[model samples]
Target: MTEIKQPIEMDITEVVKATGLASSAIRYYEKKGLIHSIGRKGLKRVYHRDVLMRLALISLAQQAHFSLDEIAQLSVNQKVPEINRNMVHSKIEEIDTKISELIQLRD
Candidate 1:
């Protein structure tokens, strides 16, 4: 009795609305390996609902001071089961260190 999750699909325009990213930006993410489109709805790129989460991760990673290359590596595929948890922890620690240093300077 293994449970399987169904994928929710959306056209590019809908994805744009959901992610607040322009079509070009979405295409760029797909090109950069951070996100991927499952297929085409006519001429529009179709993406799975999980793309929203991936986009959110990309945003968070940027705020965490991760480079595009690092983000791309971390978000290599639409299914991110291969992402290393240790690397994410390391980045969080790095952010924490920076925040602590800033606090020390402020105080």
Candidate 2:
């Protein structure tokens, strides 16, 4: 008989190395419905590879100053949600305003 291998999974440690996000942050994201662990490997949470992409998107959105609430709205079911164009335009306008303010301060 041949031995069978289990499906690929990333434990919390692997995720931390891959994402550079603290374990707490990953758990928080899961708590906020931003991402989910596929299951667990013993005491460790296990997730599929796709979660790395979701984590990347979350980090980018945070850097862009999107609130957690906004991020939640922008992601659904572990994927980018259908966006409301007006909301996206509004965020852009907000960034533009910030840029203008920063330029004025620098002048």
Total backbone collisions for each predicted model: 0, 0
Instruction: Evaluate model 2: give its lDDT.
Output: 0.85
Instruction: Please report the TM-score between candidate 2 and the true structure.
Output: 0.84
Scored by lDDT, model 1 comes in at: 0.83
Clashing pairs in 1: none
lDDT of each: 0.83, 0.85
TM-scores for every predicted model: 0.73, 0.84
- Compared with the true structure, what per-residue lDDT tens digits does model 1 show for residues 1-107? 99897659989999888888899989988898778899997899999898888888888878878888888777545475467688889998988999999999999
Worst 10 residues of 1 by lDDT: 75-84
Model 2, residue 84: distance off in Å is 3.5
Q: Cα lDDT for residue 37, model 2?
A: 93
Q: Taking the tens digit of each residue's C-alpha lDDT, what string does model 2 give over 19-86?
A: 99999999999999888998998999999877888888888878879887898887543455566677
Each candidate: RMSD to true structure?
Answer: 4.4, 4.0
Error of 1 at 103 (Å): 2.0
